[model samples]
Target: MVTLKQIAEELGISITTVSKALKEYPDVSKKTRKLVRETASMLNYKPNSFAVNLRTRESKTIGLIIPVIVHHFFSSVIKGIIEQAEKKGYLVIILQSNESYELEKKQVDLLLSKRVDGILISLANGTADFKHLNDVIENETPLVMFDKIAKMVKCSKVIIDDRKASYKATQHLIDIGCKRIAHFRGPLLPQNSIDRFLGYKKALLDNGLEYDSSLVYICECGDMSFEEGKLNAQKLLKEHKDVDGIFINTDLVAIGAMTEFMKQGVRIPEDISIVGFSNWFMASVISPSLTTINQPGLEMGINAFKLLYKEIKKKKKNSDFSFKELVLDTDLVIRESTKN
Candidate 1:
């Protein structure tokens, strides 16, 4: 209920000074800033974001759009984003696309209506059309895409080297004497999934192993779900009884396949080796620790915020900027899922 005016009156300073100090303006002395901060903290003063936006023309709020927040990868990324955004005195508003283009477009429109300073997004699986995203760019709203990104959008992007990671995973399976390797891929529209599939094929060709069409199954499921993975695995195993290895696009899917494989009395590693992407927490705790590619989710999130901050600052300066695509490296974590 306390206002900035009340704090100013108690400190015997002008409201302008109090406001400037709260915003950490360089003109305010460090001592004054410290006193203002301490008093604001003690009073539990919450600034009116709307009033601040009206005056400064900036909401100091960033919008984040993800396919699904429950996924461990995205959850870690959100944690990183929250940590970095808080340090910069910015807030984040998250929206889940739920792997639907209609829902994703609606979320984008809602965020823009709220006058968010910038947006960070990972495109949904079903999002083949990018008209909504293009609208954001045309409106001069800064955007940073992470993980699943659209190739047509000219903006900063944060992503792991999917091709290299997938290649390494498939090659590892080959080294462990796996000739018949099957790939459980996600929706083919996203560049990330396509890159992974390419890597899977490259590894087989490089190792003198024949690439079989029957071994690659495209999971058309909108979101990466365990149920879809189980069904895919069942179909693959049923069709190809000689399958010896598997490379899945996600840990969740790999876990599902593993569960199904065990249910059918098939042994893991001993009978068929498996490699998963996104080294999630549960991967290590399962009956047989999973071997996976560690996608740096937290680092990706932090880097995305830093890029968005840069764009926001540039916009304030009215400067011309070039787009950048940041590709983070991935690590192949070996565990009990594949032979050492």
Candidate 2:
């Protein structure tokens, strides 16, 4: 609660002198600057952020929107974003969309009303319209997207090559002698899901295997739950007796399918090999470890925030800013779920 007036009065100096000295204005003598800093520290003085923001026209705050908070991959991304944002002296206000387009739009409006300096988001699966996102750009707010994103939005993005990564995963299954392969794909709206499906189909055709629409199961809920995976696996079992392998959209879903398959007396790898995406930490510790693509969630978050921060600086300086698309690398981590 210490104020500049109190410090100036205590030092018998003008309030203007105290302010300039604390700001390192250079017009103040080094001796005066040192003394002012020492007094401010001894008094535990905290500057009025509102006043500072008024002068700089910056809130020193950023908004972050994600679909899920409890998931391991998203938790890592949150950690990375917080770490980077703190280093730059910015506070992050996180909002979960819960995979709903309505909630996502409302959160965007809330963040804008708060006058955030920038925004970083991973679009919800149900978000098909770009008007809300476009409004952020039109309002001159720095926007950066990551993971599940909209390609039509003119903004910076940080993501892994989902298509290429999914292709590599399907190819791995094929390499291990999986001719009759099935896919458990995510919801239809997200770009990643569409790209992954394309990659799976391409891999099948490239390997001289037939791509059957019946073999590809979709997660209609957009939540991509484990129960959905189990249901799809059950459906696959009832429909295709000769299916020997499966490529799942996510590790959580893959684990669900594995659990169901085991419950039905089906042996993994010996009967049906499985591969998944986003190598969650639990993937390695499960009974039959999952073979999946390492999606680099933490790195994606750090890079996304860095890009947003850069754009924020550019906006502050009235400098021309160019959008950037950053694609991080993904690795196929081989484990026990698939035959090697």
In model 2, what lDDT does residue 42 have?
A: 98
Candidate 2 — which pairs collide? none
**How well does candidate 2 match the true structure in TM-score terms?**
0.92
Q: Model 1: per-residue lDDT, tens digit, 12-31?
A: 99999999999999999999
Q: Pick by lDDT: which candidate is best?
A: 2
Query: Residue by residue across 203-244, what tens digits does model 2's lDDT show?
Result: 999999999999999997678888988998899999998999
Clashes of each: 0, 0
TM-score of each: 0.88, 0.92
lDDT of 1 at 121: 97
How accurate locally, in lDDT, is each candidate? 0.92, 0.95
lDDT of 2 at 274: 95
